[model samples]
Target: MRNERKFYIDGQWVDPLKPNDLEVINPATEKPIGVIAMGTAADIDRAVAAAKRAFATYSQTSVEERLALLEKLLEIYKRRYEEMARTITAELGAPITMSTEQQADVGVGHLQGFIDALKRLKTREVLPNGDVVRREPIGVCGLITPWNWPINQIVLKVVPALATGSTCVLKPSEFTPLNAILYAEMVHEAGFPAGTFNLVNGDGLECGAALSRHRYVDMMSFTGSTRAGIAVSKDAAETVKRVTLELGGKSPNVVFADSDLEEGVADGVAQCFNNSGQSCDAPTRMLVERSAYDKALEIAERAGRQAEVGNPEEEGTHIGPLVSHIQFGRVQALIEAGVAEGARLLVGGPGKPEGFETGYFAKPTIFADVNNDMRIAREEVFGPVLSIIPFDTEEQAIAIANDTAYGLAAYVQTGDPDRADRVASRLRAGMVHINGAPHRYGSPFGGYKQSGNGREGGIFGLEDFLEIKTVHHPARM
Candidate 1:
């Protein structure tokens, strides 16, 4: 087992003041792969102090200087790209194929996106009224990321903070600290100034709360459950720090009768089951047009049942397992609720897939005849579970899609161009994918409602870490 009990603080790896070591488990093997020091409030304090001190100089860096560092970091990331993929596969139980294609790719893709965004950004702009609007770095940032898309969330928050000349302390999920540690090494090798970036490993209560509530921290960027996001917002409120969140979602995928039912439904199922359906914007709820709902159901059932499950060490397109037993239990209970609540268990049901008894692998599941109010349709089951609901009319489809508390992402499937545009406008989501269009890098990724506020990615992402100041010149001479 690897020993990674040291926290990255002040540009060096230091022992945690209180060595509450935690075993990092591999969900695929149900065994400890490594150990990490669970950070305490004091650890957070030390990191915050370092960040506070570093912000003085680091926050003054020119955009060109920051871009050079980012480019260097990207270069290092490319050199170690395969290692990142393998590490994600080993630690998060993502299949090697998926890890290499999606999970680890985000580290490079988002970095490049930020590099482009930074190049286009203007630090100062003069308004018609002769007022100079300056965008300056916010002070010390408290960044908390989730485990599902480990490097994705890290780059989304950390890169922007550093790109905009802000210093930050990161508290990645305790479940997946290894990747964050590896990323810290990359940042260090990129030659960023000491204390500009720090990492402390701990749970949400101790290390996370301390970082959120610290008076010296000027902003908090968190990506996790809505419950935890609310807690972070409340904690940051104590010090009146700016808080941005990317929280939970039960996004809807509306399949109209006009679209190719077979292709659209099958593709939707694959997208939902990708990452074992742990993605925040996964189309968990599928709303089918009633006229073609039966055909869509048949396609969805086959798609779900055909989703392959395999070991993380394998190099195929199969999904591996959940990150932990806790996540497994949550997904299982939600699946059980679907059966108990009268939703048809159309495909794979609760329990590990056959031959996967040792690990925390959940069978890819699909539920048909589900209502909008059903637990399967309402909750964000971070597993390979998809819920299908049928609707009678265009208005009803839009209503059902928009009824959810989450507005992170919504999908529209229709051959009619006008209808696609109309429904896309009506749906309440930050991002709407029409006919399986993928979300590219550099576009804003966020949601409208309880899915959380503020966007991440590209220029919008950089804005989150910056403070806008308008300097007014004296009356014209």
Candidate 2:
């Protein structure tokens, strides 16, 4: 079996402080494909020390110097672009095309965005009366990323940290370690200063806790569930380190009666099923006008049925198995919960997609006549499950969409520009997609409420890792 028993720390792959073996399962095959060594708190100490050491010199790096390294990374990433795509598909069960085109491509996109920002942004700003203001790297960072959209999450945090001259101790989700390991090799290959970037693999509590509580780690940037984000904040409070989080989203897609029914429903279904509805910003809750609710259900059912779920490596596979049995069961339990709460399951339910059923594949599910109060509508299923909630008016639709504790994303669909504009402006979300527009590559992305804090992407992403210092120059009286 392929084994990754060593952690990348201090610019080299080294054996773990203690051996704790964990088998990495191939979700599509339901078998052990590889093994990784789970790390202990001691491993985190060494990684943190290395990062702290690197930050002393790295933080003083010229913007031009950092840009040069990133430029090299962009080149190396392109050379191994296909390899990264295949690695994601093998470990995460993303369809090969999705992995290649979007999943892996997102990393390349973020790196390029950071590169452009680095060249354009001014690190130091001169003020009137000889005063000056500057943005500097916070310090060593603890980057904890999720399994869903692994590389995308990694690049958003790591690239910005490096760009701003902050070092990092990354603890990627245990579910997807190989890709992170490969990415570490890329960082190493790009010749980043030893300890500027490091990777430690382990379960959330062990390594995650260690990194979260580390005194040397000056900031914590996390992307995960809302519950976990709260925990990270509390842990970081001890050191009062900076924390930037992009957490859970039960985002709403509002479809007015004026829009093309077929097009809007199909787009919403495609998004909910994209990455098997594993995205934090997936528009799983579709709020439709009551007048067109029935037609929307029929359209949603048709769209869900059209999704071809199968082997991830095969062509035309729109959906694949959930990341692991634990995730599969979580999605299944939520689907069953929807049924129990009186929401009509128009398409799929708690079982695997009809085929040879050894893997963790989940049926693309759509629920109709859902109420905003229903458990299924409130909780994040994190699977290919869509809940359609009907509303009477635009105000009510906006209200229903904002009713959730999350405010990560909201969508608006309308043929009329005025209504789309009005409704979208009222939606309480960090990001809004009007007319089913896709997420822009370098735009600021994050949430408003319980969804978590701080923006990631472009200059906003880099700003999160930086601390502002205004050189007084004696505030002119």
Candidate 3:
């Protein structure tokens, strides 16, 4: 087993204040692949203090200098991209194909997005009233990322902080720390100043809370469950720090009758089941036009059956296991709930896939004739599960799509360009996907309402890490 039981702090890999070790298990094999040292409040303090001290100098660095460092980091990332993909597969049970294509790719994509955004950013500008407006780093950021899309969330938060000339202390999910460790190595090699970036491995209760509540921390950027996001907000409130979250979502996919029903439904199922259906913005709820509801159900059922569950070690289009046994259990329980709640289980039900008795794999599930109130429709199972709901009118479809507390992302599938534009404007979501369009790099990735505050990616991401200031001079001068 690999021994990775050290925390990266102040540009050095150091031992934890106390020896609290945690074993990282591979969900594909249900075995320990490595061990990482779990950090405590004291460790958070050390990391946060280092970040605070570094911010004094790092925040004042020129944008060109920061951009150069980021370019170096990006170069290193590209050179070792394959290692990152393999690391994610080993730790997170993501299929090697998806890990390489989507998971690890985000590190490069988002980093380049930030680089471009920084280049386009105007740090100093003059207002109409003869006041000079300047954008400055917010200082000493406390970044918390989840396990599902490890590198994706990390880059969304970390790159913007560094690009904006802010120092940060990261607390990546303990379940997937290997990739983070690799990233720390790249950051160090890129010649970032000591104390500019630090990482601690631990659960949310200790290291997370400590980072959020620390008096020296100026901002908190978190990506996780909605419940945990609330906790982070509460903790940060004590110190009045800036808190930005990219939390949970039960995003809706509206398929109109005019759409190519077969293709649309099939693509919807694939999106819902992508990453083993662990993505926060997965369109778990499919609101179909009543005229084509039955046909959509058939397409979804067929697509669900076709989704392959395979080994993360192998290179194939199949999805791997859930990140852990706990997640597996949660997914199983939700599957059971869908059945109990009276929704028709159109394709898969509860249990591990055949020939995969030892791993944390879940059957790709689809529930048709689902109402908005069903537990399967309301909750985020975070698995390969799809819930199909029927609606009669365009008004009704928009209503159902916006019913959820989460407004992260919504999808519109239609043949009519006018209807697509009309419905996209009405949907209560930060991002709208039209006719199976994918979210591209540099686009703002976030949501409204409970999906969390602030936007990430490109200029919007950089804006979140910046504080605005206006300098006034005498009009006579």
Sliding window of 10 residues with minimal summed lDDT for model 3: 293-302
Cα lDDT tens digits, model 2, 130-231, are 778899999999999999999999999999999999999999988888889888989999989999999999977888888888888899999999999999
lDDT of 1 by residue, 1-477 (tens): 999999999999999998688999999999999999999999999999999999999988899999999999999999999989988888899999999999999999999999999999999999998899999999999999999999999999999999999999999998988889999999999999999999999999998999999999999999999999999999999999999999999989999999998889999999999988899999999999999988898888788778899988988878889999999999999999999999998889989899988999999999988999888888899999999999999999999999988899999999999999999999999999999999999999999889999999999999998999999899884
Q: How large an RMSD does model 2 have? A: 1.3
Reference-based lDDT, residue 93, model 1: 94
Pairs with steric clashes in candidate 3 = none
Provide the overall lDDT of each model, using Cα atoms, as 2-decimal numbers. 0.94, 0.91, 0.94
Would you give me the overall lDDT of model 3? 0.94
Q: Which is the leading candidate under lDDT?
A: 3
**Model 1 ranges with Cα > 4 A deviation:** none
| Colliding pairs, model 2 | none
TM-scores for all candidates: the values are 0.99, 0.98, 0.99
Q: Name the weakest run of 10 consecutive residues (lDDT summed) in model 1.
A: 298-307
